[model samples]
Each structure stands twice: as C-alpha cells, then as structure tokens.
Target chain A: MDDQQKWRLELQNSNVEIRATAAENLCLAGSDSVAAAVDLVVACGDVEDVQNWAAAALEDIGAPPVDSVDALESLVSSSDPLVSYWAVTLLGRLGVDASRSQVILGKAVSDSPHPSVQERAAWALGKIGATEASVVESLKKAAASDSPRLANLASRALA
Target chain B: MFWLIVALLTGGGVSGLLNPDWPIVGPLVTSVKTQAIEYKNQNPLGLVGGDAGHESANTAGAYAGPPVQSASALGPNDKILMATFNIQVFGESKLRKPEAMAVIVEVIRKFDVIAIQEVRAKADDILPRLIAELNADGSRYDFIIGPRLGRSVSKEQYAFVYDTNRIELDSASVGTIGDPADLLHRAPFIARFRPRTTDPDRAFTFWLVNTHTDPDDVPEEVNALAQVFQVMQTARPDEDDVILLGDLNANEQQLGDIRKIPGVQWVVGGGVMTNTRQNKAYDNIIFCAPATQEFTGKWNVLNFEQEFNLSREEALRVSDHFPVWAEFDVWESSGAVH
Candidate 1:
C-alpha cells in the first residue's frame, strides 16, 4: 500500500502515540487527508492526544464521505463523551446530507447524559434543517429545557 | 476622521492610511468625529439593528434603543471596554453571511479591544475583512493575529482586534507564550496595550494573555494556566495588570488551580453564563484584583440573540459564545500619575 494508505492503517495501531502521529500527519496533508477522514473519526475515541488530532483532521477536512454517514450515526451513541461529540460534530459538518441521522441526533439531544453531546446534537439538528415532525418535536421539547445552552440551540433550530 | 484621531493618540502617523498592517504607535490629536452614515440606506433589511424598524431591539449597538453612536463618540480617554469573544470557527463560511458579518461588526464596534479565539482558516483574510467592516463606519481599528496553533492539522489562531482611536497595541509585545511541556491545546497569545492618554507614563499599560483551552482537557489545561498567569506576573517588572481572558471552557469554581493564585479574580461570576445557550459560563476575563485596581466594577455578557432579536440559529451563525466585557479606567490608578 502507498504511504498515505499506510498512515490510514496506522490509525488502528496499538500504540496511541503512533496513531496520534499518523492522524496529525494526515491532517497536515490537507485535501489529501480526506481519504483518511473515516479512520480519523474512528480514532477520535482513542486517547486524548489521538482524539484531538483525529477530530482536528476530520474538522479540517470539513465533511466525511456520505458513505460513512451510517457509521458516524451509530458512533453518535457511543458511551464515551468525546466519541459522541465528534460523531455529532462530523454529522453536523455533513449538513443536509446527513439528514438520515436526524433521529439518532434527536435521541442524543433528548436522552444523552452528556451535555456537550446534547449541545452538539442540537446544533447538528439546526444545521441539517430537516422538517420531519419528530425532529421538530424533539427540538421544540428541548427548547424549554432547563439547560439554557440546549434550549438556546433547540430554539435556534426551530427558528 | 477617526484614523486622524488614532494617528494622534497612538502616534501612528496619518501617512499609514488605514492599512491593517500599519504599525499603531505615534501621536497626532484631532477632534474630528466620524461622519455618521444613515443606517436607513445601508441596511435595507433593517438587520443592522439601530434604524426605526428595530427600535426596541436590545442589541449590543442599540441595547436600550440608544441612537447609533459614532465610534468616535464612545468617550475620549475616560474609560475603555475590554472584551473576550470566541467567534466559533471564524473563517470563510461565516464570512459569506452578510447579516452574520454585520452582527459581528456591531458587537466588536462596541468594545475598545476584543480578544478573539477560534480563528480557524488556512487563508489570512478573516481579520482583514473584519477590520474593513469595522472601519466601514469610519472607525479606525487594527488587529494582531498569532500563528495558527494546536496539536492537529485544523489549528486555530488567537487575535486581538483594537480600535486604534481608543487603544494602542504594543506590537513588539505580541507573541505566543512558550509551552515546552505542551500543557495547553493552544498556547496563549500574549500582547500588551495602553489606552490613549495625555500622560504616556500614566496610561494603564497591561498584558493580555488570550487563550482557548481544550474542552476535553480542562482541569489539566487550567492548572497549567495558573502557572502561565504566575509567569506573566514576573515576565515584566513594570507591568502587573495581567488580564488573562478567553474561552476557558470552564466555569468559576471549575477553574482548578488557577483559583490558587492569590487575589486572582474573574469578572464574569457564577451568575453569568458566556455560551449562547445561556446555561454555561465558558468564557471570562481574569486579573489580580489588587494589581488591576482600574477595573470599574462593570461587566456583561452581550447576548446577541436577545439583543439583536435573532433566532438562536441565526445567533449561532454569528457565534456560539457571546462576547463578555469589563470596563476599566483609561489612566493607571497606581502609576506615575498618582
């Protein structure tokens, strides 16, 4: 495999530092890094260093491929806060293309224990701008939440 | 007209014109007030917040139905508004939105010097464009941006945008704090500033360490910041008014060891939330209460959503974090004047 492919595989390496270095390298590769976006997103659940680089790489790429949408949607419910956060972040970056993930994102907003995840999910819903009744209903309920950040974002989505 | 006054106050000669790259030091004092533009013509949609249609809106520009005050009219050299705002992902996308850009400009025009974080862009147009819009009202403003920093490829930069007519940036003092131990996600961007004053020695010269910590690594980053604050304390023998501010990602009680600094105080207390959601206080302006006695005991979190009467989504388009500000005296309280 080519060096870029090798680095993409390194994201699944056993050593956290090696994985982090790989992610950082791919991130610096610019648009050439888009091919590694999915691996980078998966690595976001790793150690803090690795997760940070992976998340940054993913964010720098702007959006992952549409084929990775299902994987990202499932990861949004990951128990780890960072995992769910990055998942929602990437899905949100997908904008309207990730419309299919709204139900999961809505569930994250309404039921996720992590406030950050909930906040991102709420923000994602607004970015998606899906008019589904369930999506609208979830945002409406969240608008009255005690958490001002969540309520603010949900209200913004409704608007 | 504002640039002329800026030339006098900052010693930045009028020959420098309005270039963002022009050095902002030197003195030329003129009382020419900025010519007021009729908002009715420029803001056709009335989204700029101060015309007849939005009279009741509580925006940063028109917080209480106040008239559209010229940037020169904020007061000469009596007091200055210092603020911190994390313009969420400020880059090309946000720049494309004129309405969002207008709100951003309005909020910034209200402060003398605003520390901006989350400037994520590969190109360098963000700050220059912002400066252009700010000066669109004939106000003289300039910006100093640090190198892009972070552990990942999507690095972010820290910037300080100041109204040259009211504040003077010590360009020589601008640099990022050294972090050999790698304690912060983004090393703080440090710079010094002084207000426009008749007595140069009495100007309240102080250092600002602008930072945005990693959300996932709060406790550790905050603890390191405490050290950074202490280092700043001894960095300069003459300056003790070090106001460290930005999107710290932690509230008052959660600031970890930074609280251990003797007499260190933050302007935005537990009662105020900095995030747009209004539920979390993720940003603040911190200082040594004893050293910076110039603080006027006034502070606020400018809620653009409520002030501009924008939907939460539109507000988020401007930023997820609201601008937090604290007022301070233009002249040094404990300096040569005393």
Candidate 2:
C-alpha cells in the first residue's frame, strides 16, 4: 500500500497518539491526496479528532474539487455533530454557491438542535446571503437564543 | 413393547411437548421438533445473536417520520418547458458547480425563458465563459447576456437570458426606464419579449427581471423592488405585460409592501422557494396588470427534489435550492390587457 494508505490505516490504530499524528500528516498532504484522505477520514466515522482533521484538510484544498458541493453534502449526514459543523463551516468558508447554501444551511439549522450547531448555521446563512424569509427569522431567533454569548452572535448575524 | 410405548407417550413425551424446554432436553429434540421456544428466546433483538448492524433497528413501533413528498404538482403539462435559476454570483469561490448546477439543471430542463441573477461581470471573469459554455451545449437556448454593473464588492450583476427566435427580446435594460442607476440591481432587468403564439393579440409584451438584493441593506432590497413599478409606469408604455422574476428576499406575505407602489399585480408567488425550513414564500415573479390576470396562473415552487428522491449528497450537488418556475397563459379583458 502507498505511504498515505499506511497512514490512514494508522488512524484506525488503537493508540490515540498514532491516530492524531496520522490525521495531521494526511491534512498536510490533502492538496495532493484529497480523494483518498477524504474517503478514509469520513469512513473513520466517530473519531472526533480524525474527522475534524479531515475537514480541515478538505477546507485547505479550497477550490475546484474543493468547490465540490457533493463532498460537503456527504458530510451533512455525518454521525458526529462536530463533523457536520465542520462541513457546514468549511462549505461556508469556501462559499460553495449562494443557491445551495440555503439548502445546506437549512439542514444544519433544522437537524441540529444543539445550540452551538444552530449558531454556526446562522452565521453560514448570513455569509451565504440567505434570501429565504425563514432563514431570516431563524437568524433573528438564534440571535436571541437563551445563551448570552450565542444571543450576541445572533444579533450580529441579524446585521 | 406396545405398553412401553404407550407409557412413554403419556408420561414423558406429552409433558416434553407441552412445556417445550428444548435446552434442558435438547440435542435429540432440536433435530426432531422445529417450533422451539428456546430458539425464539435465543435471538430476541434478532436478539438472535451474531450478525451485526442490528440493535436500535429492533425498535419497530418507533417514530417513523412524516411521509416524503406526495407528487410533483407540476407533472408534464406542456411539450415545451423553461426554467430560471440564479445561482447567486457565479464564478465565485463559494459556488459549488456540482451541487448548484445539478439542482438548477434538474429544475430547468424544459423551460424556454431562464432569467438569471448575479451573473459574471463583463470584466475578466469565468462567469461569462460559463454562460458561453451553456449556450454552446444547448440547441434550444441562445443566451442574450445584458447590461452589467457591479452590485457589491464582488458581483457585477446580470438580469437576462433567452432563446433567440421563439422569444424575441426587442430591448433589454437594467432599470425599467431612463438611466440604469435609478434601479437597484443597477437597474432591474426590463426585457420586452414577443411570445410566438397562434393568436394576434397573443403577441403581447412581457418583462422579466432577474435580481439579487443587497444582503446587508434589507431596505435597499425592499426599495429596489418598489422602484420596479416606477419602471413599469413609464418605460413599459401604457399597456404591456410585465413579469418580474428573481430571488426577491421579501416574503409573499411581505410582498404587499412591494406591491403598494402601483401597476404591479403581485400575481403568482405563493409557490416560490423561500429557502427557509418552514414553507414561507420568498422568491418571486410579481406581475403587472394584464400579466396578473393572464389566465389566473398556477403559483408553483418548482421544487422537484422532494418528489424525486435523490440522496442528500446528489441533491446538494444540484444546488442548495431548486429552481422556481411559474406558468401563465395570456388573456385580455375589456379590450385592454388585464
């Protein structure tokens, strides 16, 4: 197997140290080996550190294939909420497309009851220029959510 | 021996059959008898063990969500079809071609008139190139790119596109009339079109405006829409059909604020993609007088993704949202256009 393949297998290794190290290295090479790395990390499933590292790598790749909407959408159904957040955050950062942003952001807002997840979705929607009225209302609601900090974030999003 | 068999049947065999404790008796009985309680008790979540990917799934009477989409209200009405999708600032880093274009194409396969929003500037950009590519690929469509002006730090707006012969756009402008600067979107696209139909009066004028409002200034988006009427009152002449299309961030419920200006009839927009989780109407095609009553049309959302069960990955690849298409037939009243 290739060196990258070896690293990916290492991610599933029982040792946390080995897995974390391997994930970081794969991220470093994402621009070169994105397809393999993306597949492996996503398949890694619930490993929080590994999934996040993979998201970071994909975000770094940044254009063309990175501009790929299917890749982001795949992460929407991710078992880990953090991984899903990372996907939405990265998609927002990449500016995937204004049209698709609404749908994906809509998913993030609806599916994720976690307040933090909702907060991230609200920000992404604003960045995406969400023309939808509900997004507008949700942003307004989120801006006023129970948490003081998130409320502040929500208010800013209203702007 | 017959007495021995009768004794076995009465005392031993009958008791074993009635209670059925195969585990204790077992080895011999399992081979002979089938419906064993012991077997049923063994794999209870298929709680019958071994093979994985089970559990939680055993919760049969659990909450199954609502039914998926019923069926598309827009199931093949006419031979010719047309659709418009403004992918919001094409040729930008954020735009995912796979997701956005897939959804847009899925919705707009047949429609003849497609008015786009936030097209690439005439300056050095790939958006114009992309438009050219679309034109080259399709036979039915020959795109007419119109007056360009910058909408924000990034986008220089685009408001028009069409098939060459079938719908001849006599003139296309950013604003309804006069200097383009008067209208927001640098001038909402005002196109004069002649629909080729059998009847003479059917040769009426139609106006299409594809626009994306200022996300920062909600008021600007609102005011820009209000100005659309001013264009109709003057530039479009006394009697003409006007159909304003685009991502009007304002909801249909709030559309009254926009319609208050005059001449605009606010015809069919209840069925547009609101982009919200809740089914609130957002995108629009507010119409002028004659176009308003143009046969009292259907206000469709054009969201085919719900009916066509594409996996989430595949659907997002089309676009974040489905294209919105509205259909209307022409009708005149009191010798004047409705």
Q: Which candidate is the best by lDDT?
A: 1
Fnat per candidate, as a fraction, reads: 0.00, 0.00
* Residues B248-291 of candidate 1: C-alpha lDDT, one tens digit per residue: 98899899988999999998885788977677898999999888
Q: In model 2, how large is the Cα lDDT of residue B34?
A: 19
lDDT of each: 0.72, 0.46
Q: TM-scores of the models, in the given order?
A: 0.58, 0.46
User: Which residue runs does candidate 2 get wrong by more than 4 Å?
Assistant: A1-159, B1-84, B92-103, B121-138, B172-185, B198-201, B236-238, B262-264, B267-273, B276-280, B289-291, B330-334
> Compared with the true structure, what per-residue lDDT tens digits does model 2 show for residues B1-338?
22122222332333121111122121111211212222223222231112232111111111011122221222332211234565533433223355555445444444556777645422433333344434444422333344444321122444444433233333212222222222243445444444334342434445565555533234545665665554453432334555667666566666544767555665335454444222445566666654345534554555545756766434433333445666554224345442
The number of clashing residue pairs in model 1 is: 10
Stretches of candidate 1 exceeding 4 Å from the true structure: A1-159, B1-71, B335-338
Candidate 1, residue B11: lDDT: 32
10 residues in a row with least lDDT, candidate 1 chain B:
B26-35
